[model samples]
Target: MLGYAAMNRTLREHDPPRRCNRDMRKKTWQRDGIERAAELTEQNFEDLYAILQWNLDHGIYLYRCSSTLVPWNSQFELRELPNYERIASLAESCGDLIEANGMRLTFHPSHWCKLASESTDTVERSVESVEHHGRWLDLLGLPRSPRYGINVHIGAHYGDKAATADRFCKVVDNLPPRARARLVVENDDKESLWSVSELVEEVADEVQIPVTFDYHHHSFSAREHSYREAFALARETWGDVRPVTHYSEPARLHGDFDARPQEHAEHVAAVPAWLRAESDVMIESHGKEESLLRIQT
Candidate 1:
């Protein structure tokens, strides 16, 4: 099945502009505290249910939810939200739709989450970021597994590949079962950074985590492996589960020759047949659900 990331253009253009990524700035969070977070979180949760229902209605079951589903959740326990009960009830409703219809929902925490950072504070914050995402999935009552994966990239090499990966593996080994079981790493988009083969050998091989293949990133960091070869290696990491792959055409390829190679096109023309056949490909194009809809035709 094809999937789309956080936004849904069609829904966003609706009367009140439905969206699940409602968020607050730092000053706003500080001024209002948990109450404000509770309000936004409730709204976000409610819209998330709407979004999921829309996806199921459109036959797009794979969704990547926003990390801010519950804003400022890392600052306090989810139970501390004034509307926690209502929020939990709403989440269960979304989960029911997901499970009853065999849908898959996932989260990709922001790029700042760097578990492999040399600084202890950054690593701690990163761990919290990942754990909070896992907690959200739990509240939604999804099974604790990679199927509802929390995908991430080890975005930095920190000048020492061996040491960096060592830190990453240790952190993964120590994460609570909630985050650990659902963690999946992705190949990076810079040549100097991680490739699928490197992740397969360094991280997944050591920590038993699945590797998510990003099609656009492969060209930047192929590490001498063909796309099929890299994908096959990443696929092996998923074990019994269907591997998840991210697909997007570069905007440059889509006629904006000046656009960066990593910039996603507004909409993808078509997905490769083999990728559609084997994995749940999340269309990373800017078109979101509309992109999936276009290719479906």
Candidate 2:
């Protein structure tokens, strides 16, 4: 099965704009007034349901959800605001619908999460970000498994790849069980850092963490690894669960293909010859669902 990331902007998009409230937007933590907050939360649930239902109806069973469902979420004072039970009920219903239809759901938190950072503050914030995503999965009643993989990239190499990966494992070891259970690492887009082969040798091979292979990253990095080798390394870590791969073409804004190698184009890349027919892949192009449908057809 194939999936696309976040919302399908090319498709009908509906969003309720943020409203004015007593909420303070600054260095400190504060929340919008309860009544206003509840309205926003309800809006989020409705938007998600609309996207999920649309995907099912249109024959796209796999989808990725945005991590910012609740603004200023865990840092704020609001938890179960105006109608906690009601929203939780709705979230579970959404989960049931996905499971009933055999849809695959995924979450990709922001790349700013760097658990391997040498700074104590960076590590703390990273842990919080990961926990927030895990909590959302809980609200949706999704099982803590690769079926709803929470994918993230290991951050900057910090001049010592081995030490950085070791720090990553240590931080991951202490994660809340639910967050740890859903965690999966992807090879970074930068060539000088963690390539697919290096990632397997350093982290996934040792800790049994699932590896999400990104073909664009591997290509841009100038790595000699083949798609078959990449798929084998990732699939071994995943075991019976289907391994996920990412596909994207480079967007050219200037001189040549190398100008913006890391940026995803607004359309699908050609389906590679080695892509396993039974494997699950997610389109990372800027066109979102439009790119995904293009490649599938």
Taking the tens digit of each residue's C-alpha lDDT, what string does model 2 give over 1-297?
788887667444434432111122433333344555566666677667777887787788888887766556654533556677777877888899899998988888888889899999999998888888788788889988887888988858999989999999999889997788889998888777787877788888777788888877877553677877777777788888888788777786323466566887888657675664746888887688887777666
Question: In lDDT terms, how accurate is model 1?
Answer: 0.94
TM-score of each: 0.99, 0.89
What pairs collide in candidate 2? none
Show where candidate 2 strays beyond 4 Å: 10-35, 76-79, 253-259, 276-278
Backbone clashes, candidate 1: 0
